[model samples]
Target: LTVSVVVAAKRENITHHQHANVGDLSSAHGFHTTTSTSYYVTFLVESGDRIELCVSGTEYGMLVEGDTGRLTFQGTRYLSFERI
Candidate 1:
C-alpha cells in the first residue's frame, strides 16, 4: 500500500546490554557488551493524519524531514519511500 505524505520527523533509538560469559572465568573476559539500533519515521498524510513507522537504517538515511513523498508499506511494516 502507498500513501502520499510529508516527512514530519525522524528518530533513532539505541540500546546496550551486558552479558556474563560464564565459560571464561577470567575477569577480563567475564562480560560482553551488545548494542542495538532502531529507526523510525513520522509522516503527515493528505488527510492531516500522522503515522509513525519503523524503518530500516538505510531507509532512515534516505528520508528527509519536510520532504514530500509516497510512502509504501505493508500493514505496519515499512517497505519503501519515493520522493514526489
Candidate 2:
C-alpha cells in the first residue's frame, strides 16, 4: 500500500512513502476474505497538524471462470498520535 503525509487545505504532499504487501489474509470463505494490516510513520510535526491517511489498491485480475466481480473495502480504521 502507498502512504502520504499531506497538509490539509494546501493539499501539498510533504512526503511520498510506500509499503509494499503490507497486509495479510486473516480468513477466507468462498469469494470473500478478511485482511488485516498496520502501518506507522515516524516524522516530526507540530501540534494540530492536519495529517491524512490515504490507502488505495489496484486489482490485477481474477481467477474464477467468466466471473467478473468488484472488490469493496469496509472496516474500522483509527490513527493515534504520540510524541517520542
Candidate 3:
C-alpha cells in the first residue's frame, strides 16, 4: 500500500534537525592527529510537501509489503525511508 501526505502552508516551524555519528575520521593530519567526531543528517518533517510512504519501509525493507503510514506535511518538506 502507498501513503500520501499533504502539508499545510505557514507551518515551516514543524521542520526539525537531528544528527548522527559518522564514524572515526582523521582531520588534523599533523603527525599523530586525533580522530574527529562527525555527525550525519536527520530530518524533522514539518509542512508544505506530500509524503507517500509505506509503514513497513525502513532499513530492513517492507515487512508485509503493503503497510504504509501517511504523515501529512503542514509547512515543511516530507522526508523518510522508502518501504520497498
Candidate 4:
C-alpha cells in the first residue's frame, strides 16, 4: 500500500520523452492510443513489460499486436519525463 502511494504521488505532469517502441501496441490497423499518467491498480508490471497508455486516467485492459507507441517532444515540451 505504501509503495503504491509513493508511486502514485511521484507522478506529475508527464514529460514528452523518448521513442521506445510500445512492444504490445496491437497488430490491427485501427488502433487508437490514449494518454494519462495513471496506470491501473490491478495490472502487475515487470521490467520490460510494455506499459499501456491511458490518457484518460483509467486502466489498461489489454493490447493488440502491431500497435505502436512513442512519446513525442518538441523544444518546449515537458522534460521531467526524461525517462531517467
Per-residue CA lDDT of model 3 for 5-77, tens digit only, reads 2222111112343333244254333233234332222222334333333222242232232333343333333
Measured against the true structure, the TM-scores of the candidates, in listed sequence, are: 0.88, 0.17, 0.19, 0.16
TM-score pick, better of 1 and 4: 1
lDDT of 2 by residue, 4-70 (tens): 2222221223344433333534323223334543332222224433333332221111122222222
Tens digits of per-residue lDDT, candidate 1, 1-84, equal 899999999999999988778677565677888999999999999999998999989989988999998998898889889999
Given candidate 1, what's the lDDT at residue 48?
A: 98
**Candidate 4 per-residue C-alpha lDDT over 1-84 given as tens digits, one digit per residue, 9 for 90 to 100:** 101111121122443433334553553334345453543211122333333223223212222233233333233231112111
Candidate lDDT values, in order: 0.91, 0.27, 0.30, 0.28
Candidate 3 lDDT score at position 49: 35
Error of 2 at 4 (Å): 22
Which one is best on TM-score? 1
Give the C-alpha miss distance for residue 44 in model 4, angstroms: 14
Off by over 4 Å in 3: 1-30, 48-84
In order of listing, the candidates' clash counts read 0, 0, 11, 11
